[model samples]
Target: MANQEKKRGIGFYLLVGVGALFVISIISRDKNTSPTTSTSAASAARPSSAPEPPKAPQIDARVTARELFEAYEKNEIAADNRFKDKLLEVSGKVDNVGKDLLDTPYVALSTGGKFDILGVQAFFDDASLPKLANLSKGQDVTVACRCDGKFGNVMLKECTLK
Candidate 1:
């Protein structure tokens, strides 16, 4: 009789624990769903427009190609956190002015001497190609561009002549 009572007590506690866990799961599930439901309802009630482009960050730091490259070479994560997605004004000697695989115009600036492999690769849109066409190798140039962080080189986008 005592063994039977003990077994019942253990089974009851196990069932209670499982029930409590089920109740907690349901409560957590409700909590997660409520925010998403409210957000969807809010979005549905609002009028939509064209998505805006990312604006250039207004920072006073005049970062050069060599400096930006060296920073990334030293510590990529720190350099990315500092320079990524920010507007930068870079001045360096032009290494190449050419089109990419998509025929998108680009300007590459040397990070070191002409023999150096690392460069700042700035991509330009179609409208900016005419301006990019005139740039020659070994020319000193200044450009304002949005830093997109480093790959093999310091990548920049939406560049404009400065």
Candidate 2:
């Protein structure tokens, strides 16, 4: 009967639709998880030859941690104009040394108050973990880094002992 034929056609189309969706999902999953795909993408983005050694960033200024923190606390805009993104040699008495919420190592340098909550925060790379482990609170230290402006604390990034 024509009615039976129509039902069969609808069922067939539904089954085909489901099969097509399943195939598409598998293909998309493969594209997402394929190691070769990621490897090829990484290769395309990298240089073909040997990479050169990284050069040290030039020092733009030198100041104590208190001086740096006070500068930002006084006038954020003026301080940023003078030190933001510029490499600096900052020396201060260490207040703390620990990893941040994201596991980034940092050293907090005192900015002068006996019960101060904020200080200059200097972030170091993972390679500096051993060096950071050797630091103690109240010890004098100097670091070279780029000033990343203030966010509660004056942030210094890519820091290394100087």
Candidate 3:
């Protein structure tokens, strides 16, 4: 019994350490990426830039997941309506992940109870999926996406593991 308890304790600490390292790596990557992107007057800054770019999206992901959902709820008259249609960029956790027939990956984030994600789907292009493909279910993350409506649809354009 004592040996088993000790093993469990060690396992818990090891997991925590690994999680911390992962977080540090993500923060550094985000920082290193931002300067390179903003300084270079690339496509995102251009007026005719596409709706959302993987490296840089139209909306900022720093805002908490709850804030975006609450904002949309406030703006829309009916919560049951197309609440997912808002052009929001927010962050949350990867509640589930799946692979399509084409071998592309899709991830779903929990709205933290602010919104319902019944049949909605969030997309992550090729660039951002790698950092998160191997992640576990409960991993916290921030995603840049355009919500389709409260009907529970969102298009994920970017992701940063927090």
Candidate 4:
């Protein structure tokens, strides 16, 4: 009968559930596993003579924001010293100084009344640069950036105000 078959199916499921729970309970018992003293002693006696791994080079280890920007604006700080690859933290102003004659969004950084155009076409895109929509003229802030070093060429990326 349908009722009998339904009961049987329910019972089957209950049995399976109980079995699974029992198996899990058995597996959950902690095993007092530990390295043997002999093994540890052997390791200590031999010891790893290999040199320790080199520490990760911190970003500041190379250059800071001011240094990176100055290098680009100067361009005489060695050609092999490409800085467009590092993330630099900078302190400046947040602004959208209007587009150029060709209609590109322009951003300026004000530092002690000496403002420099971010120098590259990049610091304008909505994705890379900060929205700066809430900012007023001359509001000071810090930003993280990567520099593209070309003569009189400096752009900021990941521009964020802190």
Q: List candidate 1 stretches off by more than 4 Å.
A: 1-57
For residue 141, model 1's alpha carbon misses the true position, in angstroms, by 0.7
Model 3 ranges off by over 4 Å: 1-61, 73-89, 100-104, 114-121, 146-151, 158-162
TM-score of each: 0.62, 0.66, 0.41, 0.41
Backbone clash tally for model 4? 0
- lDDT tens digits by residue: candidate 4, 67-122: 55565556646622665556555565544455556655545555332466543322
| Candidates 2 and 3 compared by lDDT, better number | 2
lDDT per residue for candidate 3 within 16-83, as digits (tens), equals 99999999999999987775655576756766845764564344234555655565556645532543
RMSD of 2: 8.4
Root-mean-square deviation per candidate: 12.6, 8.4, 19.4, 9.8
- Whole-model lDDT values for every prediction: 0.87, 0.95, 0.59, 0.55
Query: Candidate 4 regions off by >4 Å?
Result: 1-68, 73-75, 79-82, 94-96, 99-106, 111-124, 127-130
CA-RMSD of model 3:
19.4
Considering lDDT, where higher is better, how would the candidates rank from best to worst?
2, 1, 3, 4
Whose lDDT is greatest here? Answer: 2
